[model samples]
Target chain A: MAKTVDAKHIISITVENKPGVLARISGLFSSRGFNIDSLAVGETEEPTLSRMTIVVKGDEATLEQIRKQLGKIIDVVKVQDFSGLDFVERDLALLKVNAPAAKRGEILQIVEVFRGKIVDVGQRHLMIELSGPEAKIEAMIALMQPYGIKEVARTGRIAMVRGVK
Target chain B: MSKKSKTSKPVERGREPKTGSQILVDALIAEGAQVIFGIPGGALIDVFDALYDAPLRFILTRHEQGAAHAADGYARATGRVGVCMATSGPGATNLVTGIATANFDSVPIVAITGQVPTNLIGNDAFQEADITGICRPITKHSFLVKDVKELARVIKEAFYIASTGRPGPVLVDLPRDVSRAVCEGNPSSEISLRGYKPVYEGNIKQIRLAAKVINDASRPVIYAGGGVIISGASEQLRALAKKAHIPATTTLMALGAFPEDHPLSLGMLGMHGTAYANHAVMESDLIIAIGARFDDRITGKVDAFAPHAKILHIDIDPASISKNIRVDVPVVGDAKNILENLIPLVEPAEHKEWLKTIAKWKKDRPLTYSDTGLKPQYIVEQICEATKGEAIIATEVGQNQMWAAQFFTFTRPRSIITSGGLGTMGYGFPACIGAQVGCPDKIVFDIAGDGSIQMNIQELATAVNNQLPVNVAILNNGYLGMVRQWQELFFKKRYSHTTLTGSPDFSKVAQAYGAEGRLIEKKEDVRPALEEAVASPRTFVLDFHIDPEENVFPMVPAGEALDKMIDGLA
Candidate 1:
């Protein structure tokens, strides 16, 4: 029960797109001793507001507190934790793999298997773009490790409830 | 000018365009502000100039910190939004401790800080500081007003944020250029923040669950804190306790929220709290905690605190619920509102056995001190007796604060003002001045330690200049008594740097500030000095030389269980 309660949790927050809003949210987390696993924020469909997705690992109690504390900030409009909810989650990752001429075909085959796209090809590296769940991204990264991965940039998790209004 | 030139700006309703500073002043007046405790600097010269003819009374505090604390004290005493003003950089930095002090205790205050001109903001111009950023963590909310047109709306938002749910300090940093610029728009009176609405009503289902728990419990205790006073829920709390026949214990912040003289009153609970209160909490089957977070001071060892209790916590801040203690039932809303709803659902019960047990414990280990010499506790009792428990008492942190809390039977909400959460020294005098200003008809006293008093002792000049007639009772023990006590008990009496053998005469210091002073080395002179100081029309300091080796009784050493207290009776 404790282990289940204490696990990776993803929280989505909608806030007014004003100056210092990010600073306020980030500052609250730091002051409360909450460590963020990943954070992604951008302007929403409404130009006046921004949506933030924060992935953090904490117990149920701590998560509740984080949700409540986040709700307390004046700039934060709404907080929703996608726990035990039917949602479609996606994260984008760009991986620069060391694609040797001898192994280029093998990397391409692996990319095709994962439904990924080869966006940029350098003399010795291939920048592959993949959009999937975090676990799938991690699995791809694991498979690319033997092929000598150079660097990776990942956009943190973003999710939408299925069949929402 | 003679012909009303067409090139001039158009008048709005026969009124000329107001400067940003004038708009700020007008906004404050519109918000119903009566006084502003502040200091003027170069960046704030325009605001000060505007304030010169403004209807609001400006208090010139000796330091920015004093101004902040005075504002906090005024807010705590009167339940109104207290306002303080200071310049940029160092002036704003000086208000940090006082701001944090108010923030920790959830006092409603608006701190207005002057900034360098907009163009010079990030250039590290003279007296420039990122005050909004500096105060971000300490304040409930903060704003840096760059445009003069937004000044009125920002001020409205700042006040609204500061005085609303779970009230706390808010900061507004105004650039010098903004202050000087013309604001053509009318000062905004309405505030609409999409993200700032507070939940005032508790969920009916949760309230019913809490009331059911209260009705079923055989040994229940009501633990109340500052929220009771802030929400004006003391009457509701008292009614519930009487109806349920459950004993009640208050935190230091909740001292005056529940009358200590009431039969079911457990006085105070936690470190240096009443023996019966601690015992009752530890043995309670149900703990209906209202407006009070289970601070470490109250729950000594997290796992060992109230080991047998099923906790029901009520508060306005949702984060505060179950943050420290795992609450069984949580009702997140205003205390008064929640209590009003819960009171009707609660059924009456006697709990004769529980009350008898608490009564026996109270009788067995009542708060006591050796009445032989000039004890600080004795001095506190004398002051309480002199005031008939009606004076608004402010206290600096340490032994004196604990003694005051222990001795005084606080019967009214907002009557006892002390730095509970932050425990900041040098907070009392300025707070006392603010309290006196807020409640002019009532007597206000600052019970202070010799060490803590000196931290912000310069506030005497502010009090004297304003003719506040506030009294200060200095419990002079020639050392940092609380630290010395810890050393005596825990550190084998190393005594380190706690001693102040050559401290200046406080009475003489008071006299230097053009206020009356009296030195009392004997217990016989304690009451007389208090009377004289209370009667004096000017600010007065009563320096009472007390026992150097005295320690606060019923102390649960840090990290020890609540019941593991150290005292002669224990």
Candidate 2:
């Protein structure tokens, strides 16, 4: 059986901020069919350099090709999949779960296990803040469906390498 | 005046008065434009009349959309701005989708639209439309010519803006009065504009830093993007990769940057990327991104994406360097020119160990899919093998697109012309029309999906009329495969209106247009059908009844990483 697994592949690439570079990268993605998930970019310390964090979800085969292409770009500095390494990946999610006094305890216990904190406690609603892995947050949302999910504010996912050294 | 009337010789020597239509033809010829693809309209009668007498070549298409698409083909094929003229109202509106298509893909196109008489500008006159305003967002620039004297200059400006900077479509709306007016100016004279200035040179300081970083990193991977192809730097990229011994991967648009069969070539990257290609980028210490942007599909999860590597992004657009994914070293210049300079500065390394590791990863899991059922892959494979992997292909959007991307092994640049940026449904047929127009010597195939082909099916008439023959291989899955794939994965296969059960008989349709059309039911017939189609003197449309339920494997279910692909048909 061909087993397919999805993972977050993050890279902190640095490059000179010039013209047509984006078109090149975008053209690369489109022509090669590198389907990205969430892509965020910000300027780095140098005025001419910028940092790009790209999130893609595909099989291992796909991720490998994506890394190679991402790295090959003249503007790209580096690409890495920190999932197996010491990288902390988190997605911020805002959940508005319907909460009355009757089942508040059940929801609260579940939120605590997920390390969530209450942002607002209205008469019939409890807005909680949860920041964790994308899958975990997604699972949490699924479990709270019985409690009634009024709204959801998800900030996709952002990652940083983790280490004690 | 009285003396002139009597003197016969001087009176007869006055230059002939040119109609509005004549001026348009004159201006186009002066601009070095040889072709005009468009439909003849009542408002544009004068222009057509003049066009007939002029030296310019005009391809009168059946539909306005076909005309626009033909222009798209002409422009993309020749790397020159293609010109097409249409009347106002229905004629102009019919071209909206094609204009947007060119705009999204950033192709060099010039569209000319006729308008109502000057007196009836604001009123809803017959065959009148506010095309200038209507095409605002869809065009890089648009001009509404109220004065006939400014027609030539406006057209010149339109062409300049379209083909120069990040190529896109531009429109020039000519009112009836303006077309009829006498505007005298040399279209080829030295033109100046204080408004437009596009930067072509790179920042030296940044280029030097980029060179240093690349030289410092031992385990480096070269990631080529579509910019390499757009900038025509495939040779430069090849030179750099060979000299530096840096393994490379390309995005879809960058398919031709390096030969796919090359040992250094890791194949395409992103959702359906090969295991080795993604692993090399993930594991490498330094990533040299050339002319590619950091798209969301390529990076599964940013924090974890290529954590071990440092990125050096080179692009022509300043905003793209750090717009989506940040880069450590930003080199903004033309990909070809920049790579040419950087290749000489870097030290060549054997890196056999690193290359071996990547090869090991590649072997661990080749992009394998079983021919277990009736799917587009079967057909795509046959096409590749039949063409000996040396044919130019244009693909329409949907499952057929995915199949082509996965199964086709392209070895050169511009070999595959598909709508990657916009994913326009009907893009395959029109794009192939353009590709074939550009490279008629090579056997060109339009790998189309049933749903996508219907979007521009009218082009068959244009194909037959113009005698620009191309083989159209339709993977008739009876659904908008891409959208259906999405619904199956995310929406639990509710199977909305995406499914198409009984479409118009493609063979009958093709025959009606005076072209050969073949319908293949069994797998064995694919190759034979392909051969017959290619052998035909005229354009051919081969429709295959692929399994509608067949799904493209190696799919990354919406918010997952590249490694987490969903295998098998859903």
Candidate 3:
């Protein structure tokens, strides 16, 4: 069987801030076998509404299906697929990596180049915060891997479409 | 707040104080709800109290499942949102199957379940269940009403959401405290939800393109489904088919959308579909799917289904268009609107060669069975003849359902109700009661298999008590007929637990329920038994001892193409 090539898609949905709405949305994705690469949700400007940014990997047809299915949910206010749009995408990562006094200088140099900040410091580790596009975050993590990374916590990608168009 | 003012005007527009339950009743009545089928429970006592003097008529069903299926039947019969209600916990849980059944078949029904008090909701109070959460997947939408002010709006929204676009079941969980609370204000009648706008008009470009495809195809077939009935597009579908001179096939849900007796009608197409219909679909150069999702049963072996055809799918739900089978053109809108738009652009063309080929196939392999002792097919055929094909026939899932779909010639929309998507057993009897209730003057019959009927047979009392003249024709083969058929073919006749040798006599059961009952074992008794049931002023059950070894023919084993149907008892 010939398979359609899968592509990464960033979909944002605004929904009513009610219990079980998240379960309904996420359940639909999981039920249809659509893999969620990353998901981030928070309250929108309207206190009664919540916005969810979901990154999924699927073919164009499958993504279109997901978008339409999402639109069908009563609580979902709007679903926008930013896969084909020029958007500002960002991911925030908190890395607690092992950094001795000698290695701390090397890690600091890499963090400085990536525009990261040291949020906390321990006797044997430094917790660095990095905020950027997924690619930049990936690069920063890769460079910090040699410093004997101990722990990593990352917020999934969130996106906003560029200016009025 | 004066006592004199309250006493003088009990229900003054905005001055009188009404309980939350009163507002709920008023909201339902305002939404054009004629009747509700449900059972009362502890959590729903206040709602029932409010309903006691309300304008609505409530049919207290024996079981919550019966209430739900009855409501589903009402919705399918009338094309209106059917309403069913029950209290929390077991009462609410019993409605789950019926809700799923309605959901699977896209029947518009609003199920209102009573919950524990607002503060006690998460604590799992007596008779409490997280019904909204439990019903999330099965409902089009669900609401947990905590505040009295939101009750009216939520009810209105539930009706709106259930009846729009691709219709399905919606649930509203009303907490006991909310229903009992007193609200001084009038419930709002208006609904403004930003997220729920359904597109009803097809794209002009796509409509035109579809018309062109229809006009140019050499072997075009119009495959219609339940959406045609939901959108009331049967007339438009017939017009398009007639104008384009195209043969049409309907799914199980779309049985009556196209006249089965028409020259262009291919009775049904799929697993239990007619041989000619399946063959026509297989050989067609173009398939214009109007409102029909290419369900797995309809499109046997998706990759090989209509392999030679260029598909055009028109439906109200955009999600259903290319969800199953790939299509060359997709039209997302109401079926009626799209069909109306496409009919004008369609050019009249005669497919003489194509029609000739289909006619030959029809003549070569007609749906037939040998005249044997009390055959189920014979009973279904007799019923069709006796009713003149006008009776509202609901069937339990299995051989009986297949036989009804195959043997009965349906001529009008909403005439045949069966669980198509869910293939649920125990759906027919309660649904029969609902259909009879909705269409009081129409003759209703539940063509049931012995095994399937027993699943919800207790509803016989509900039918009898309501004085509904519902005729239940049980095809008793002493086994779960369809599963047994599969066992015979695939499981080397092991039979397993398919046999129901100890099953009670359905006729006796009907008699026990204070309804008319008859047992027939001979072929000659079929017509008279049916005639007797039809003429009876009360509910009747006619149990026919059909041949145990019989099977639904023209079987296309799962995962095989339509053309590869294994015909006959081989």
Most accurate candidate by DockQ = 1
My TM-score estimates for the predictions, one after another, are: 0.97, 0.73, 0.97
lDDT of 3 by residue, A1-165 (tens): 237799889999999898888999998887778899999999998999999999999887888789988999988999999977889999999999999998888898889999999999999999999999999988988888888889999997889999986
Query: Which digits, one per residue and each the tens of the lDDT, describe model 1 over residues A40-154?
Result: 9998999999999999999887898899999999999999999999888899999999998999999999999999999999899999999999989999999999988889999
Q: For model 3, what is the error of residue B220's alpha carbon versus the real structure, in angstroms, after optimal superposition?
A: 0.6
Docking quality band of candidate 3, CAPRI definitions: medium
lDDT score of residue B436 within candidate 3: 88
TM-score of chain B of 1: 0.98
**Candidate 2 chain B least-lDDT 10 residues:** B185-194
How much does each candidate deviate from the true structure in C-alpha RMSD? 2.4, 15.0, 2.4
lDDT of each residue in B434-485, candidate 3, tens digit only: 9889999999999999999999998998998889999999999999989998
Residue A137, model 3: lDDT of 87
Rate residue A96 of model 2 by lDDT.
97
Q: In candidate 1, which residue pairs clash?
A: none
Off by over 4 Å in 3: B1-14
Clashes of each: 0, 122, 0
Worst 10 residues of 3 chain B by lDDT: B4-13
Ten-residue stretch with the least lDDT total in model 1 chain A = A1-10
Error of 1 at B431 (Å): 0.5
